[model samples]
Target chain A: MANEPDIQSDSLLTVEQAIANLQGADLGLRVYAAWWLGRFRVDAPEAISVLIAALEDEDDRTEVGGYPLRRNAARALGKLSDRRAVSALVQALGCSDFYVREAAAQSLEQLGDRSCIPVLIRLLNDQVPGTLPAPEPPQLAQPFDAILEALGGLGAVDAIPLIVPFLDHFIPRVQYAAARAMYQLTPSPQANHYGDRLVKALANDDLQLRRAVLADLGAIGYLPAAETIAQTLAENSLKLIALKGLLETQLQHTTPPNLSQGAIKVMTLMDELL
Target chain B: MTDSLVSLIRAVEDADSSNRLLEAVENLAAARLEGAIPTLISALSYNNPGAAVAAVDGLIHLGETAVPFLLEQLDAHNYTARAWAIRALAGIGDPRGLVTLLGVATADFALSVRRAAARGLGMMKWHWFPDNLLEIAQAEALEALLFVAQQDEEWVVRYSAVTGLESLGLAIVQAHPDWRSQIQSQFEQIALNDDSWAVRARVWMAQQRLQTESIVQPRLEEQPSPLSETDWQMIIEKLYDRKGQERLVFAEGDPRRYRELVVAIAQNPKPV
Candidate 1:
């Protein structure tokens, strides 16, 4: 139905330009290019290598102590799905910027590298000493939510005891993250308990927290949450995305392509949302 | 004005360091003196964000008393001042600022200005209008909010517009019961079609609020001393104000208290 030349030219031209910009002198362009490559899931070797190199970028620092380039590069590398990026991203875990470390941890989870487990585990106990009394209550120095999610996604069964304590973490988002990881590490009947914690989070007044819970539910494909997710006070599109994840998981487990009851329920909910 | 108040006003204009300027503005704002209104409005035009923020807070604290000066002194050339002024007016929620909010919500070049205006439009003190003119004023606000919701390029502005529409919709449905279906249908269409997930999510929340309001309306009407639409508006405003306070405290203190408050708020029935 569409012209082949136009499609090829459009995508290729954009990819090449993004690659060029990632290596360019402009800091903003480089940051944008890194995000573009990751957003489009560009998996070309050149793109991956350039993005890897970007992880070490020192040029794009913010005045308030942030490394925008490194953050974007680390995020892009994860989406690129290149094993070569695993080492660089692991090293980025030590970056001074809190957000860069957060982004690196999330990317490592996506890359699914088991070797990064020890480093991530150490991060669970990492606490940065505050200069002042900490105007707010003391939070984990390390990004616990990202680290917990990463550990869970990487299938670190030995880290289960470590993850359990965070189920009662002070922050609701962190608590939800712990619940998400707990379910992922142990997907038995007890997974429903973790699923219930996530369900309760849907009632949180914070929209951002609710959005994160939706993503976590979708990521783990917890079918028990499908109906509750549908009725939650979140965006219908997010509800649909979460339901799609549940349906996909159901289809994967079914021997035949025919919809299982769980899949049918997810589809029906998705239909109502649409 | 006292000499210290005059000094604080002068200090706001002459302070070299950002910290000093912020302190001066905060002191003046905390004073809550009528004479300091002009200086607070002028501070909105300053390059220091901390000073501007303090000034906006001060103006909001002055309430409707500051509205006339804010309306007359709104800077045409300074976008920063205009944006902060819009925030002040939005926070005040005086009915007199409705026209300005409507103007900027639809046409402001700055997305932040437009976003503030859009949200502010819904929060207007509709009770200030006489019974004869209230519907007309509300209709104008609804028209502007609908335009912004459907046409704004920024997702954040459109998100604010949806928020405006929801608040205004609650007010409208109570005043004219026949309009409930139309408002609900409009929200449904937006929920089904909006490009931003956040916007759609907000619309989804708005739909739930509308449905709850519809169910509660008859019970409210049956009361010995029936709650008027203005009473419902005041309650909504108080809840929103409480939520805003919770957010501010949540950022700087133990979140356990904030979480407890959120739970309490959620458990309580919010009459639309």
Candidate 2:
């Protein structure tokens, strides 16, 4: 149980009780209430204003508490899906807390606001060389994946050039993120050369890397990937996602042929296996 | 990425020595790489407790994505790997893990594996999926858990089975209100006749929880409740120390002695 707590269902409070606890004296209670409010997804106008106000909260006890109040607040705002939260979330991109900034970027994506694209693009390579001075046992605020994912989720096509370089980064996770972001920024399978690059990565010997690229190809609805994804369905672990992706690609094909046939075969296999 | 982190991931996948592989598993876990899930699933066969634990923790961190890979590992030739996979799948509590969990809970040769399966089988609460799947999985899981609770040879396994039943019972009561009286009778039967004081206490507690309000907080943290990690760990340590090679003599004897001991423990202020 290194760090993953065996979470039990919390004794939940009502909306009014939880909203009241948002300003409670105990930081844990406040954070718990913030999460509960989000989990419950209450749409009270008063709740939205309070959650928005909580975005500016300065509690920096992440080392002590697993989640910061502001991060939970940002996440709650996103769950609300209220467009009124767009400007505050955009400004939250500049929050000193890395997680708070990440949460805001993710919420902006969920809110489906294109206005925050330029603001989020700045966080694509935000990891610095050293730790902060104030937060003891300092940690760098790496917003790299959140930013890439947000850019992808927002369909920021102009950010493709910015995302492509990270595909060769020494970190495998960075490469994975870059591949996913590349797929997201590419408007269509025919729009960019990244599709070919991803297809090549699908044949890469690394299982994790191959799976990552396969998921991206699926997400982009790359029709040429139908054959490869269909073959991968032979591995049961990859079957569910592979079938999902192949079906997505199949729907994109206007003229049914070998690609559509392959998808049909895979779907039959899924029906038998899943 | 740190050079050590990348090296550890590589070593976990390709190391020639068990020691090297185990060390690599520990390092990868320390780095907390969610991408190292496949490596962790592979490391389960090493038969090193520390490495198995690290792998389990890593899989737990990966959460939902780790479910299918974990389910695949149930077919591993190594029983050790299968055991760890059952534990990890149980820890994740995903509905996808239910079928394998039931298979292992009822038929695994190893007591530890069966115990893990029994405990895990009860943890299945399929709220995320369609009601049809949820109803099917939950009913099958309950059937498997009930089998282990009533018939497992080892007292420890039976104890875990009861806890599993309790967990499934609580989930059913909370969500499936229709399953209340039937599950309550099952708990009361175990409470009245279970051989072990610990198992009986667990059943009584379940009965009490069911008999009481829907939202009653646990009265004691030290008690061997299914949800408390620390208490479960203690129960496991205590059970393993006694070594259940022979059946409990008191299991078939007077119920009053076991009942009194359970009451004293529950009512006492001191920690167990």
Candidate 3:
């Protein structure tokens, strides 16, 4: 008789070990477990419940008043593809730590929950009093980039008017997020105009901003930008990833045997990069 | 070497603690002794990142004097030491390191090394080269920079290439007036099509600077005689060589008009 290993048994062991570490006293191990569960896409109910509980973790605070555990947990929850963690992620949007809030917004986007749209939009207009401007590029207190990106991914078209002003945001990265969200919310024909703003942002001297804009272009499947993305001065790896995003987007939106000229161009570019 | 320099060198080589090595390197670097160059360069091969950084700073402080030693001591087997050596060579901006800088900027496995080398290429001390050799050197530098700008896989390196191009362009325009049109055209193309917005933005800033800065004007009066038909034909041929046939084909019907158009464009290239 041929012996086949039990894949289910191995996964169960991993899930149980991750759950134990998540509930363990060691803060570092808990953080690792949270990341492991989400990274590996563990969808166990125990994993979800513990990750949700971790969002409220009070013990794992950074010297600068940031919540490392809460941040990692929130990030993992989104990757698990579980809707059960959505409410906890939404609540995490109110965390004092900007990164925690950013992480929460990103995960919430991954969960594809529409209920978080109102909360995210409110953050667009959120005016935190007494908060000092960011050291570089001088942005507002809220994680506007993440919020806007999440809103766009959720297809919240109603948030368009509110997001428009952020195109003029002082921080270029935030402006890029606004442009990306605008492109996502606007329908085709009108959408390329917003995509152009991102294309223009690709000229910014900040590598991070260029990378972000490339990602935004890819996520929106902005095929008009394929040539530009391919030629962009970013690392080939990042350029390839962005092009793949565009290709995936094209595949999903087009029918078989009728790839648009833009799609064909994107594939050609990807071929060259590969 | 003085007694104090010897002791500092000993401290750098024999110190077990990272902090001690860093302090020794710092003191040695601050000493600015010519003899300390070898010791500082040796410190680069040490495992401690902090000491290596201090050693690089010290070598930079040594400036032109350290260039020859830096070039000779570049470790082919040790990437960390080689990277630090590149940084030192880049920081000094010595003409002697130009070949090394060009080689690494184009082919270094480490992105940071390539980045430093790319930036260094633009800032070489042109005055150090003899007038006869300056033109040739600048041309080589420009070609390397153009290749890096268009071809480097990393945006930051490409970005550095733009900076190098601008600085070198400024130097070339001052020294070799005939090269301005080519430099201007190169910048225009980079600004229009470079994928990284940062690289594009840098090109824009460079164009603005080139326009606003009145570094040098063409010395038309210095020519002993006016351009004859043969000279004009040669100029047209050179233009064709640089821009290809398609770009120059527009003014084929009228050579005078073509010459005028070329002059106008070269005198006032369109802003990116």
Q: How many residue pairs clash in each candidate?
A: 1, 1, 7
Model 2 regions more than 4 Å off: A1-8, A11-14, A39-46, A59-67, A125-142, A187-274, B1-272
Chain B TM-score for each model?
A: 0.75, 0.70, 0.74
lDDT for every model?
0.76, 0.65, 0.74
Write model 2 residue lDDT over B136-201, tens digit each, in one string: 456557767777888876665776776677667776666666666666777767767876544554
Error of 3 at B144 (Å): 36
lDDT leader: 1
Q: Give a tens-digit lDDT track for model 3, residues A1-274.
A: 0122333444554778889998989998898888878767889888899999999999998776778899899999889888989888888887777788889999999899999998888766784333233333454578899999999999999998999999998878888899899888887899889988888877776567788888888788777788888866564456766876776576566554345556556655653432
Docking class of 2: incorrect
Model 1: CA > 4 A from native? A1-16, A19-32, A35-72, A78-103, A109-115, A119-274, B2-27, B45-54, B72-80, B107-111, B127-137, B150-159, B174-180, B190-205, B212-272
Per-residue CA lDDT of candidate 3, range B1-272, in tens? 69988987887778787667778888889888998998898887876655776778788877878977888777456777887788789877776677678778887777767877888888887654434334545766787788888898766678678778877877787666666677678778877787665455556566766778748554454312222334334433443344352253445564333545554433442332
Worst 10 residues of 3 chain B by lDDT: B223-232
Off by over 4 Å in 3: A1-13, A127-139, A256-258, B1-272
Q: In model 1, how large is the Cα lDDT of residue A237?
A: 49
Q: What range of 10 consecutive residues in model 2 chain A has the weakest lDDT sum? A: A128-137
What fraction of correct interface contacts does each candidate retain?
0.00, 0.00, 0.00
As a whole number from 0 to 100, the lDDT of residue B84 in candidate 1 is: 79
